[model samples]
Structure formats: C-alpha cells, structure tokens
Target chain A: MSTGGGEAEFEAALREAFERRGREAPAAAGLLEAVLARRRRQTRHRVAGAAVATALVAAGTLLGAQLLRGGEPAGPAAGVPAPGIFAAEEIELCLLPGGGDPAEVLLSAEVGGEEVQTAISEPAGDAFRLHVERAPGYTVRLDVLRGSVAGEPLDGARDVRAGDRPGRIGDAPGGGRVLLLETGTEGVLLRLTAEGTGPGDAELLAWAAKITVSTGRDACES
Target chain B: MEFDDYVLTRGDALLRFAHVLCNDAQRAEDLVQEALVRCHRRWRRIEHGGLDAYVRKAILRQYLSWRRRRSAEEGPAGDLPCAGGAPDQGIEAIGERDAMWRLLAGLPRRQRAVLVLRYYEDLPDAEIAGLLNCSAATVRVHAARGLARLRRHPELTGRAEVVEDA
Candidate 1:
C-alpha cells in the first residue's frame, strides 16, 4: 500500500484535506474551552474545598487540620503541553442490585456530541466481551467503564424510580437484571453476565470505569 | 482530563475531524465543542483508554446519525447539499476531497467505520472488529464493499481504488 506513486497521491489527498480544515480550526478553541469549563466542575470543587479549608485554618487551630489534611491528594502542578489533554479522575460507579440475567443493561458515554454505548457480554466463562459504539438519535459523550445488572432493583434506582426519573433501561424479555443508576445526571445501565441472574452482577464495572481516557495525569495516579 | 486541559490538547484534531464529518465548518466546530464539554463533565472516565479513538468514533457516529435522522424528517440540511461527482485532479482539490466525503457518507455505518479505521486510522481488522460490533469477517466484508463503492465513483479512477497498487 506504499508504492511511490501511490504514496505521493495519498500524501496529496491528505494534504488537501488537511489544508481545507486548516481554514476552519481557528474557532474550535473557544468551543472546546466552553465545553471543558462545564466539566471543570471537579476542579472547581477541589479549589473551593481548599479555599474553605484555608479560611478555616486561619480562623482557628481547631481547623488547622487543613495543613495536615493531605492537601487534596497532590499531583504534578500541571499537564505537559503536547499531550493535547489533561484529566482528573475516572468515573467511580457504585452498583445497586436487581435480580435476573444481567446481559441487558450496559454502560454508556458520549464524545464529540455522539453517543458511545457499551455493554458487557458473557460470551464465555469469566471473560467478558465489551461492545462499544455510537448509537443513533440523541447525541452523548459516553465516558464509560465496567457494567453489570442485578436480579432485583438497585435501592437508589428503585426508591427514586417512581418520581422525576424515567426508566430508560428495562429488563430484557424473559426477564433480566435491572439495576440502573442516575449518577449525578448521567445514566448507567447495569446487568448480569452470561447465565446472568439479577442485578449487581460483576466486579469489573468499578475498576473499568475508573480507567478513563488517558488525558488526565491526576486520574492516572488514582 | 480537566476541562481546560482537554481544550488545550484535543481542540485541533477534534476540530479537524468534526469539520470533515459535518461539512459545515462552523457546525463541526460547534459539535466538537459541545461534545468536549460533555466529555469534560464526565472527564473522569472519558479521557482514558484510546481517548482520541473513542472521541473520533463518537463524533462521526453522532454527526452521521443526526444527519441521517435529519434528512428523514426535515426538508433538507440546506447547508449540506447533496455532494456529487467532479473530475479527479492530478492533485486532489478541496472540491474533490468533498466528493470523496460524499462517497464516504453513502456507506453503511459499519462499512464507513471499517474504511475509516482501516484506511484512515490504519487499525488492523481485529481492532476494527473490536471497534465495531462484528467479526473480523464482517470487517473484511465492510472493507471490500466500502472499497467497491469508492471504486464506482467515476472520479476515483484507477488511481484511488486499486487496493494492491495502493
């Protein structure tokens, strides 16, 4: 696939495509910055905590506990410039159980206004096949990790199941695990593995979710 | 990644990819911007793994899916006029590239995905198979069909479509 003429032509095509985009990339910074600002909630939360602790420490030695408080789990001051990304921590998910085969529910994330849906399959023993892709219709930025389902409903999803929260995930036909969590505003579908029984199926979900995109150094340390 | 850091890093590539996918320069910028914001809110996890890969796939899928549904329900995209054949130049022009874009748009999501992964990202069939939900056989099929469709475009000529020669 790398003959001389072929390589030249390919280079030309790629070059043309790149040039065409060069004209439009200028405004992208503003848009990306705005989006990141929204996610900066975590950073804001941390800074705020530090500010509060500092003020308290000044107020009295009673709260000087701030000095020895581990200082918000320090990391390198900032990210290196070239990686084109910085990150905080991976999403941490806590499972609530519902009973049945857990194959039905999956975890989801969105990227670039697109939906990235993920489901864990028990195609065999102990090993899980991850199904990740974009879904149609509503757009999302899926930052997904680990997934499971339980035999019965999870306490949070079940207790709050009736009110403002609508159930986006349902048990699979012939019944399935049905544990769902509304983490903040994001939704997660948990299911059981192959021969899957009720909700709260696997332990992998917690570990996987935390292994988010390799953008943030802070998240990596955790 | 932190919101600021995400912008710092991915702004350019995501912007470029989104531009190609959406056609409208401004809209691509908007879509990428919006996506990143959402990603940031969920940055804890989204920034991990093959983040670039995940982000690229997500953007294209969202762009294509939205385009598909919009075409079905709305009058027209207005900005996205149906892209059609133009002569192949010795060096690809902006217009010729746009024509290739249209051809890519014609492919099924999986086929398009295979071509993008195999040809663009240069991911192997196994990896492409993992990316899209199908067997390696399915990846091969998609690649074959995707190439065939590209070949059918009159502008592609003997140059673009010759796989072995490529």
Candidate 2:
C-alpha cells in the first residue's frame, strides 16, 4: 500500500499509533510504595553486606597480625588502626544524590603524579570520575554533594585538609581510599574515591588538594 | 513538592510516557519505578524545579542503557489493542496503525526514541538530542532513517498510501 502523500502521512500515522499505544498503559497503582520498598530493601542489603565485609576484613587482619607475631594473641584493638591510617579497604562511601542534570564544568583541576584523565561526568552535580592510567583498570570517582558529611563510614575517619578546605580521610571499600572534604561553599561536601588497587592515599590526597570547589549558582560549580 | 505527592499526581503520565518509549507496559512500569526511586532519593535537590523533566530524563536514560532486555535481533511484536479511536474509523485504518506499530518496534532503539520524542512528545530536535546525549544532527539522522524504514516496510507501503489518499 503506497501512501502517495509520503513522509507527512507516514508521520501522522506514526504519531497516532504512539498515542493509541500510550493510552493503553495500565494504571500505576502502588508504584510509589513499590519504589520505596525496593529502595529500603536495597539499603538493608547494602548495610548488611558492608557489616559482613568489615567483620571479615577486621578478623583477617587480626589473624594475620597474630600469625606474624609468633602466634601471640591479638588484643581487641590490635587490628584496628588509627583514624588517619586506615587499611586501604573496609570503608563504605555514601551514595551521591541521583537525578542531577549534567552541567558544564565551570572549573577544572590537574591530577598530579599519575597519568590520569580527569573528567567532570556531571559538573552541575559536582561529580568527577578520573580514569587513572597508572592503575590500568581502576577508576577514581569524586562526588561533591550539598550538606555536611554524615554517614556510617565516617565513624573512624580522621580530620584532614584538602587545600584550605577541611576534610576527612579514611579507608574505602575494595582496597580504595576516600577523602571527604568541605568545599569553599558552606554546607557543600566533596567525596573522592580512589578505587581499590589504584593510587595510594597520599597520591589521592594530593589530587584532592588540586581540586577547587567553587560556589557558583550550581551545586557542583567546579 | 513532596516525593510521594509528586508520584501520586504524575505517576500515570510518566508510566504512559515510558510505555511509548519502550513499547512494553511491564518494562515501562519498571522504567518509571526505577526513575521514581532515583527521583525520591534526590527530591530535595530536584524539587525546586524541572522535577518532571529530570524524572523523564532518568527514565529515558534507563530505557536506553537497559541492555539486559530483549536482544536487538528479536522480531517486532504485534501491537497491543488500541483503547479508543475515531468513532468512524474503519478496519483499514486499524490495520495501517498496527503495521506502523510493528514497523516502529523493529527500528533501532535510538531511532525509535528519536521518533517518539519528535512525534509523540512533540519535542524539538535539540531537546531530543539532549535527552539522548547526542547532537541535533544525529537526532535528525535517526528520525530520518527510522521514518524511511517504516515507510519502506512492505506492510505499511500500500496501507499508508491508501490512508494518505483518503
């Protein structure tokens, strides 16, 4: 069947088809409840998984230390390191805010030491994912979000400074290090994650220091 | 606006939009639900404005990146029954619409997305490009190719011409 009218007629038919199909959609009853329930379940699973992983890491560390010390019994606090000097694993970072519109990068930073490509994945959202060639397969993600840093993993984080901004340094899950810093803007927090087996904490901190978080109109100005 | 309140008010519309995007009711609901969950998480930041657009973008992203769904090689499925149409519509028109639907389902995901956004959503090429993360030229290319393929389909070629003549 040839529509002598051509493209315009075909488009009209297509639009009508879409409208008809759209109207047949089922009612979205209980969708909000389902979403909330799924979110809660996911949170529970993450928390439980983190707890198990942390326990195993702590126990393994204690056992290894004991074995190294000629089978001497390790004390309760033996495996736990000071806040500033955490094992390169066992820290869990909080999830960044979702649904942020991708914004243009108003500021940029240089990553010293490693041959890394720094990109602002969502500059408006203040999130950056740095692909460090030195680490081969690992990615370093830095997310800046509004509000002070408050979460489960911050319990043992030690205070540090990135540039002039105050921040905290701690171990991150999967053999990585996390640096949480306060940006120049009051109430905005920045999180830098050097994935496991990637750059050392010192290098990560150095890279963090190079970042300049500006208080532009957007949440992630820099 | 509160997250729950927003969902209550606009959930059906979002679901409908998702349905048009993916051409599957169940998958559409899943997309909307996932987008809403993300929206709920960041409602505090997005609630100030453009909340609907953000959620719609989230849904579109999820639909585009959902690689685990049906393979691209799969054949286009038959269209679901249209709920309502013109009172005087005839069988030929219905057949034409069904053919169009099947042909649409056969197009590449991005092309289908471009067509839907252009015709159904009535969005500009630039806006569709933004949602799809491509240039406006690419959007037009997709739309052109998709429409070309649909018009060329053996099923719609004759029926579409007849409809146009009518």
Q: Which candidate's TM-score is highest?
A: 2
* lDDT of every model, 2 decimals: 0.43, 0.61
Give me candidate 2's TM-score against the actual structure: 0.56
Number of clashing residue pairs, candidate 2: 8
A1-222 per-residue lDDT for model 1 (tens digits): 235466446535534544454444434435543554534654686588556534432332221122222244322211111110101122222222224323322333332333444434442332223432222321112222233333333433322121122222334354432323332222233232211321121111221222222212222122
Tens-digit lDDT string for candidate 1 (B12-109): 76766665445455466556654555455556767476677666655655554422323321111123221222334455454566666676677776
In candidate 2, position A84 carries an lDDT of 23
Interface RMSD of each: 10.7, 9.4
Query: Going through the candidates in order, what fraction of the true interface contacts does each contain?
Result: 0.19, 0.47
Candidate RMSDs in order = 15.1, 15.6
